[model samples]
Target: MRKTLLTIAATCMWLAGTTAFGQGKTCEEAAPWSNMAMVMDLASYADGGAWYKITPTANSMLPFSLTELPTSAVQVFKGCNGEKALVMSEEVASGNISYYIESGVEYMIKLDVSQATGSFVMAMATPLDLSNAPDGNYCVKPINASVGMYSSIKANRPTWFKVNIVYPGMYSVGSGFSVPAEGAAVTSVKVKSGDCGAVENSSNLLMPNQVYAKAGENFFCVTCSGDMKVLFQMVSPVASCPNHPERMTALSAGVEVTYPNAVYENYWRFIAPETATYQILDKAPQGTILQVGTLDENDDAKFFCNFENGLMAEVDESGEGKLLVDMQAGQTYVIASETFNMLAEGVPSVKISKDETGVRSVSGSSRDIKVSKVAENEYRVSSYLLAEGAGVYVYDMAGRAVSSLNVRPEGDAVTVKLAGVPAGTYMFLIVGRSKSASTKVLVD
Candidate 1:
């Protein structure tokens, strides 16, 4: 069921004699001595207020205060994208306010002093320093850090950091993943070069990585709203990360290898010598997961199969993290651990194996459904074999949604019209009530 969030303006009306939309005694209307900008940092004080504006590129959660005690009632307001809303007005007022600021919007911070005296104290500090994180780099394993975004709403100050690597190898940050906001669809946790540096200068083999870890100084940070904490740990590297993973040596079929569990996350490059469907088998202790994905020429991993996270093809129910994948020979495949929120447990060794038989990349679920372009801006979807309804969703190479259509079978197939779309290559994902299938389409 879909629930709509009700946002009622929490405004207060304070008037001893006169009547107006705003309080009779406001910080802006009161004498200069009545309102003071005591501080501009949330890491220090809990009482004070300041004018805030949305950061240029990112969303901000500006923190502020109203009164020290719930002794009076006055209406407080917060703004978003230059629009203000009644934050809260209560008989007792003493608490913090978090303003969800939109980029490019200027907002005002005012106190209500009609029913009771207004307190002025605000705390918002920069880079909310992590202990011993000079130059914003943490050199040790299981490093924890916080990017204080809730207090830095008016400023686009992203918590930045670099790892002082004692050794050089591919690494991955584990556990304690930072969330931008509750219920947000997408968020990123990554490592880059020195503070906010370019991707190429990153010490890790993969820039902006989520699962793959690097053992080098690849700086790590998160871009999101609210205060967040992330955990970092070094990971084993696949020997190949020179931008082109395909050039790396490929693992032969039917080979089982014992890898150390010391590295929580491990990466391996597998090159399919021919078109085939393959299963990656992990015989490690229970709960050890296996992730596999195809990398482009630039070594960028696509939405491959992740059995551990249950985001892709289903693995065995025993929870050992076995995954099936299909790809052409010469394709670069990289596999990593999808561990979250915990350290690697006792696994004597990670046993890895694969069996393959050449086939197409279609799923057994959507085998009855087929999508193909019959003409420009027009495609044909046939689902005569399906026992249920289906829909087609278009997505870009990076997995961002382009559009979707609720397709009904006209006889044995349905025709979909997608006009005015620019020329490009996109992945077409077909969804049934219970199962789904995906295929790539080139638009001209």
Candidate 2:
């Protein structure tokens, strides 16, 4: 919306204490309202009234207010070219007013003062543009800690925003603002889903504003009293993770990794070369507490190791803790490290060490399992534990089961054919009634 300054003078004629038409007194002579305060000389105009034109650039809910209007009435007309129709009328001593407006439509506002004396201040709010904002439902970007949007809200008016959810998860939506006048505050924030006209599901979000949202669109309505400037913010747990390949680093066992600067959170991608148990140790400055967790294919929290749990030990005086877990070969995993305190400025450093206790066989069985690739998408498996009802399962690196087949032994070995399977590194597990053996295989 563009801003413009407009001022008009009216010359009135009075005969036998009766009012006459003058400039800015009729529909055709109405001055344009351009988001600025207009001063009126009530004694110079007939009936102590003035007319103004309002034309919006987009569909908006305009909030306007009249100050020091002790004895006044406001009327809104739909059309301007002499075919005027009264749409709304309000009688107020002094306060805010709101009306819905459509794009490219002409409207007129008539302010009448019954006292026929002094002047009053008129203010109108501009429609905010949220096209580039990440929190909007139609926006394609995601919001982080560094990005936040701001807008103003008027008293007794509702501000609407469409919240866009790209990834379904728990999120925090919060607002911060300053109250410049009495009764000026943000009252409530409501979230709704489904049809905007009909409420399918609606809920109010209070302080510590946390909400579980699905991947789609949601409507947010904010109501406030008085006029205030608000800062809107939205954050997700996965916002700190490296979303691209360039931001993520590889993790290998026995290598100590360190970041350049202190960060709230950091992530690393790890692929196991052999099936075994590994221990991760965090070494940082004293008084630093870190939360270690793992993410799944959907980037959701798969597992977390905390000080309260036995999987992770408490930080000692030297600020050292260990997390022990077992990993399978040919499987991928994401490790996430986050700090509880934002004030802590120590950089993150961690080292992963493989346990020398060796791989623990399934069901305590010591059966030897061997897998060898022979042809395209074909592998030969030889296992002593193969028996009736024994089956082989194939899983991709992400631990998603892709194929399963029942095996029929021919002599001592069986040939497994993966016809439609894509070329990738996969884990093959042979399971019987009492025992199971697994091996990693690469398909060309």
Candidate 3:
């Protein structure tokens, strides 16, 4: 009886191989496998299993899937002899599996199954190259472009694109395609500098995916699970304030202008007529967000300060929606205003005026108070106006008070120490009984 069963199995195997099962049953006779090729009806063969060999020309991360697996496991080995199993199926779904391979290495994949009468399809995925894709700009409207060759992202694998950035700033990448709710979500979207060696930043498929990129060639790797027809859009901070003259309004001192009720934010360009401290006041309803900054040659936002709900530290208790900023002569600055709810209602007015408080000038002061850096984190403040128990305060560029101390003048100068203060540009304000002086200092 045992010999009869063995003979029947051998005859079945021979008949299957001669008819529809051409794949090798042993590692030594494994057939060659190529990228994006599908092997159909793999489980219909009478042989217990089949083997296929793969040789990658370049290092790659490949994903393999089975339509209807009839076995418990599928494995990849380092060589045909199966001495070492590099990876095994994790079964993301019932039969889907993925693995990574290196260049110049031979890999043998085995589909382990016993005489199953069912059929299954095996498919492999390869990376899609977009290294030479044209550069995209955030300031311009996005145009749809086809991405992968396959219809499904699961079969297309990861898609890589290069970004040539001329300016270092905050940027965002968004996809026009989305995975179906029934399908798996996108695995990852990564940003790398120079090459695809290491990931510098990653983003989700949803939300405003943002990444801070430097000036150079940056690479992006996107992996998804659904449709492959994706259109990726890159957005920069400049997208908010376009370079058109109509978009950036010119703001002059002492001139008040009514902001139109619009959904988008409004921008104002202010070129300092003279080097002085100026105050920007927003009389826009009760809640509004104000931002002040300058655009570099590349139109990247820099030195920006956000006043949440139009509130600033410089404003007094009675003052609302006011910001005092020290501006330099001949330098251009940008002022942006937006409603708290992202939609403006009624009339919103903004005004820029010179701040003529008793505070000394930032560039040069005619006040009696004088401040000089004595050491790395130490400064000598001298002034006859600084009486006993005078208040000394330090503020950062964002108008936030960092440190404050009360001291008595040591003869002509009082040593003020900033031990924990970080190195940057700061403002020092010294207040006496009836007078106050402020000067800007750079700490190294």
Residue lDDT tens for model 2, 133-178:
3342321221222225656556666555666655333444334544
**Model 2: residues with Cα > 4 Å off, grouped in runs:** 1-248, 260-263, 285-295, 298-314, 342-346, 356-444
Whole-model Cα lDDT per candidate?
A: 0.40, 0.50, 0.53
lDDT (Cα, tens digit) per residue for candidate 1, span 1-444: 123222222211122111222221323442221222232122222222222222223333344444432222211222311113222112233454443333454334433222233332322212112333333332221133332212111112234445554333444433334554343211345454322212222223344434333333444544433333444444543444333344443556777555543323344666777776677766443323344666544245523322222223221223355556666778667755422112234443333344445433423333545778898789876665223444456654433346655432223465566787778776565545544555556777
Model 1 C-alpha lDDT versus the unseen true structure: 0.40
lDDT of 3 by residue, 326-416 (tens): 8889877777764321222456678988899845432223255678888778998777656433556676654445665544322445667
Give me candidate 1's TM-score against the actual structure: 0.31
**Clashing residue pairs for model 2:** 137-162
lDDT of 3 at 439: 62
Report residue 247 deviation for candidate 1 (angstroms). Answer: 7.5
For TM-score, the strongest prediction is 1
Q: What residue pairs clash in candidate 3, if any at all?
A: none
TM-score, candidate number 2: 0.26
